[model samples]
Target: MGIKALISKPFAAFTISKMNKWKYNAVAAQEKVLQNLINTAANTQFGKDHQFSKIKSHQDFIQHVPINDYEDIKPYVEKVVKGEADILWPGKPLYFAKTSGTTSGVKYIPISKESMPEHIKAARNALLCYIYETGKTDFLDGKLIFLQGSPVMDKKAGISFGRLSGIVANHVPKYLQKNRLPSYDVNCIDDWETKVDAIVEETLNEDMRLISGIPPWCQMYFDRLLAKTGKQKIKDIFPNFKLFVYGGVNYEPYRAKLEESLGFKIDSIETYPASEGFIAFQDSQKEKSLLLLADAGIFYEFIPTDEFFNEKPSRLNLGEIELGKNYAIVMSTNAGLWAYSLGDTIKFVSKNPYKLLVTGRIKHYISAFGEHVIGEEVEHALLTVAKQENVEITEFTVAPQVNPQKGEMPYHEWFIEFVNPPKNLKEFAVKVDEALQQKNIYYKDLISGKVLQPLIIRSLKAASFINLMRTEGKLGGQNKVPRLANDRILADKLEQYIIEK
Candidate 1:
């Protein structure tokens, strides 16, 4: 074993042992984190404005601070961007993580000195926990490729500004610097396609063992790899490849295709990292749930998704959350965010250690006709049916078809780019519709009541979603296509990309 492989054994043990102190005492750790954050930032202007010094309990914290979306806290973020000291955190942030969304244009999220370590440590400890669980550390000796954004940062009011991944690139530990692949210059390329091509060149012959990125971007890199080397399987190019780490989007839709392209089933770790915080990670190889980072400088509140739009939603702290119920996560962090709504939804599967599965985006749902359909339900329905039919989906999205052609009833329109499309498309669509009805009662009622017809599947051209993402200027690095939309904006746009058989 290489020195890293040998050293990782004790390191992993020490790290996971330290982690257990908080994991077993998760709720208490959360309470302490909230108090620490509040106490630490009490001298800041935001703290004073919100009566942080006076707050003694979670309820008091909620009463004092309203749950804020990015829009609600835009003023504070603006001030922070202007180099205002103690505007949000105790002092000016070390960096601004610049993120752009479809609806919310550009957002500058603060990365305070205190919060930065939390992000870094949580990521590092994820690997440690994995090593402890599986006793696999030899991959650390081989080149580790992080399919990420440009490491080049920009200046905003003298504060370093860049994508979260880029900011993280600056923090890659010196030890792993030698093992990291895709030269810095290649990573700096602006165009994603150009970057992937360059990456293929740089890491083609390297002893790459671990690959990490969002699923779509990783697929892009794999495609580029095969094109450049003419390798049938990724494992053929780098037989050492054993681990695939992914975040940002659900991997179920792309899993079969990725494994097929790679020519083998590989180990994967799902991470829940947002610009706001490093929330959770898969600690066990056996379970799909990601272990929540309770002591990672972020205090979490689970507001039931059903009550999210109410005047004052019930913001339940860690102890109050129940398993199997969907909740919109609200976080108060050392970054100085007070009761910030993350806009992502999650369901708890385990309680003591607080392991969870990210269901979908809170607002990214299909509720056009009162039959609220979520990403989890849709994915479960489609993937379940597709598996039984031996169909492989490359990419897909759903939109409510509020209006249909003359003499036809409106229905849910599924636009799918299939890797292995079913032989009988109509029968497959019926199976998917039935699966969806089994998952959601509202959707079943609408279908049975004749208010809506069974879903219609539109087989899209190969790389349709890719072309759409590229055209929208969001081709890579944590950008994801929403699985379903309530409005026709995305769905309507997808109409032109459709290919009729």
Candidate 2:
């Protein structure tokens, strides 16, 4: 279905006679969109040739796709590598968004011109929904500091990646475009280092009213900004920075450090940003995450977290899903990714389809040793331990690594940067272990010597962690220190610094 039809379809499916009455209409509309996708995909050559053509019903679609991971899509990506078009979409692609695939190699996902409006509208709906929930529409009128992806692609007619933010930046409304804090659009520039440097120079003097971007990149920007001005507080640089909008990864680990670095507790909002599109945002003033734009061209599927890694993950479309359980998000966008599993996991906070929270990345989950520990579980467990001990953290990452000692099970090791380091580090470690044990039965079993050993909490000077990432060519700019490293490569590297010392 076209964008205009997609918008109106929901209303037509159910009676959205008034604004308050629109909720039922949304649910109805979502089903219609899915039906349309099933029909359209059956008719299209790409869809027909692909497995999606066999999807006689939504249930069949879920049963057929097999919940693809990045490895499964590698062959398609190889096609993309050869400059092939019409693989995912019907028409010639506008460009690709070059985002690093967390589990494997860097991915260059195609974006089509037709899909661009869906992206734009998704962003608009995300913003409008936030405003609708909090009555904060006036905030959009302020000077905005967008910490967007730097444009590395030279503008041309050919399909390319690394131009997502550039495309979005150039495509926003002209009136709002005129009001941007810095005239420079980082996403449009070819050289990242030069673009970032220019952005740093431009914002040095301007009153940065609102800052928005991935938290890691924003953190780097703020860190450099603070260092340059010789100021300890965030207010010192951008006195007018009323709102701090961050998305992408979980910001819990960095929250204490960010608050410490900034010098004030600014209101923060977490958004779910993807290479495909902006999926959701925390719309409530109380800071709760919401789901995808229900009325947009995006259609969603939720696979139960328990079955997420299974070969045939049993899926739940909008009507079948329930609240409070984690689900692997499968999505179909106007971008032509039918039943595309984007490796994101979320928990429903409310019964409303739009009310949801980003719990963790699907790849970040650790169940290797039967301990299905997720990012939220770890974050909460750490918080519980900290609260009990009255200690505060700057930043942290948790990894499950094999214990070097003979006959020991895999254990979770934490690299923590502390604001208030406990005098007795061993006691602090015990407290954290106790908290995790209480949180998860599996963790408790592991701690009691039935399975794994007690988790080891290693404290590192905050600067050391920062320097480590910097030395790896991953420090500063948009790169974030990975929170939950699944394998030995990152875990072993961290172990050398955190364990040996």
Candidate 3:
């Protein structure tokens, strides 16, 4: 056996065994995880405040701890930042994953040594599981290029701070580091544009076997590689490339374009890892759904999307979740997060293995004029329209046009940056409107009652999204265009950047 296969053989076996055990008894596995999480941190301040010692069951834990967002947890995190020990997790956190804040500047999430292993181990198992199921071990022999964020970490109040991906990239195992591309020196370049240029120069002649990144940014890297090599597709440059692993955004819209760039079909794996913890990953090649890591370091709770905005919402554990319902995910993790709102929404597709699809974000939707449209609905409508029109969309965003002149009704306006523009823009808009009306009853009712007008579509020039991200200081690496907005806050700004036909 090759060195790659030899190194991964034991891990692949372990992952498969764990997958089988969890598949048969996901509920039991989740309950055990919850009990372990409680017992692990029962002495921490947060655990004591919630009376974790007295808590005997999931119900007791929920009854004591309320669901919290970043704002609610800031005070405790602040204490940790000031060198306080055992504020949330036992002792001090090893590092802090700094995530982009919605209103605030940046939110520092704790990542304890206790939880770091969970993140690294789960990601490793995700790949190993894919290898076991597909018998695809050649990737282990070649280089794996992970287009991650900058690994240059900053010390703040005795803790390291940087992007979660960057931190994880720095921690690639010693054995596998030989197959990983982009030297550590190049990864430390903080400027995104400069980093991409350096990565292109470094990996141009390498024998790459696997590529992992968010789709849009990975597309950027692939474009650069093609340009440098004068190649038509990525496969032409890296013939042995076998897998494309991605996460942080839905891959549906980018799938067609990415395949076109690759020149052939390749297997893919999707993972759902947040700054707080690694949540779920695609285990079975037969299904697109991601299997929840029930036995991992995180304990999960779900609140129905419709009830989440209420003052008090009912929470359900893994055993209580029903398929097909949208639920806002709440998580308690080894990283010192307790009943924390991860701001993500998901819909279960399978129960035996507890597989799910990420539906949307909790605060990301358009409900102006009572036409409640979510990110998933908008993406589905756009995909339908694109497929029907034989077009490819690179990036897009939707916002409600609530204010109208006299004799005008409210409507949802779409700003789309297309790789392949449709032959007829008017027809494309009509198809999109029809799709949305079919998918969302609220939107359809508004249109039927004349409370809303037909959806508006505006085409943006190529690379407009890159410029938008540049202007917002989030040009690359895990930053994605917000798919839906309640109002035209972003739409109006984007209008200035829109290309006139």
Candidate 4:
């Protein structure tokens, strides 16, 4: 809007266009790179195979390499830990990134030391894209406050590539590292609480210009900051702050609260962080969901949502995919993961391949009945119903509960917390029922007596639910009661608190 910004608009636009083009080109080149890696991994016997076998096409590779889970790679991880060079990939094994495995408490994911450069490049590209889109290169000089894991190392720990955060911290410039705040370094294998006191101390050292981390953890950190400094407005504490980069979960549900507490329209960016890799970022001006980093060190394979959880998946390539359709993401990464399911779903916003929006987690879905309900669907439904009834649902959740009285159809019990309570509560409930029925045909037919119509709108105080979670031992800053519930156990627990009150 300024004279300088107006004059410089075209240059910024050009940079964005060029960066987007570069990403598109990278997507197009994925097949060749993937083939090369597959061949090289096979030739060098990275995991189990030994022989540079030919993979002429995408189909050939998929057909030959069986789809594998973490369990399949456990042996290779063991080998790498024993200093078995080139066991996972044809390079020195970097340190392992620890991930919360489903069964195993923690699993160390392996990465090639050579691939570290790729991670840096991908991260830089995200920054460059952000700069181009926001047209805010002036903030580049400001101190960035990355709300990342603490950079503590175990005395006997050797440099491993699996803990993604540790790898990043290890690679940051030593000069910048020295100036980093006195926080509990928890990137190493250590209890997080051990360093909490130290982290609180470090946060007071300087005014952070940029804040980056998972939304929950960042919120928790700020809550701690509030306690430490007796401050409410984060901007007052860190007056120079320009951006708040968050990811690892959807921020929409908590955005209003965060903005209110911060006291500024903080520029926000979302990132895709995983044990396998830092996959994508939010770079668009309007869209809030993360854009797939197509040009990053991973070649993507998308399995249709219906086909994703199947034992035998029908995977689609970039050339074969469509927009708005949900797909489970699989990637061949520089970290030596081939056709690995990333446990996330994404939809393409544009055909550019490099740009995508993460929809939700694969595991987080509630289809108790025939009505398939995902987090996005639930969020959209809540907004729609609230709009129709002229109310704002500040907090809500849907759960399937059994109606043992025999004749009634099972209902989706909703617990809603509204900023402005609706006077026409019955009409509000009807509107919500109508919204659900219209959006999902299964629910519509069910409402027509084919099955049970969903019950909507049981209101409760917001703090009551928060207090319940606290009682359940998930307290303090980060813990949030899940927005959707499928089973009766968690649903019953939530119902007991909100149903009566």
Best by TM-score: 1
Model 2: CA > 4 A from native: 1-24, 50-56, 63-65, 73-85, 102-104, 130-141, 154-157, 185-197, 387-390, 406-410, 476-478
Give a tens-digit lDDT track for model 4, residues 248-270.
66776556556766887888777
Model 3, span 1-501: residue lDDT tens? 587777677779876886788777989988898888888889999989889998889989888999998899899999998889998889999999999897756899999888888888878888998888877788888988988988889888889989999999878988789889888898888888898989999998889999999999999998898998899999988999999999999999899999999999889999999999998999878988998988777889999999998999989999999999999999998889999999999999998878999999988999988677889999999998798778999999999888867868888889999998998888899999999999999999999999999998999988888988898889888788889988677888888767773
Q: What is candidate 1's TM-score against the reference?
A: 0.99
- Evaluated against the true structure, the overall lDDT of model 2 is 0.67
List the candidate numbers ranked by lDDT, top first: 1, 3, 2, 4
Please write out the lDDT profile of model 2 over residues 193-270, one tens digit for every residue: 455566778888876767877676676677777877888877887776777877766776667667788788877777
TM-score (all chains, Cα) for each model: 0.99, 0.86, 0.97, 0.82
Q: Rate the local accuracy (lDDT) of all candidates.
A: 0.91, 0.67, 0.89, 0.65
Residues 9-45, candidate 1: write the lDDT tens digits.
8999999889999999999999899899889988898
Residue 400 displacement (Å), model 2: 2.6
| Model 2 CA RMSD to the hidden true structure, in angstroms | 5.4
CA lDDT of 106 in candidate 1?
94
Q: What is candidate 3's local distance difference test score? A: 0.89
Highest lDDT: which candidate?
Answer: 1
Candidate 2 colliding pairs: 96-160, 96-161, 151-187, 234-262
Q: Which stretches of candidate 1 lie over 4 Å from their true place?
A: none
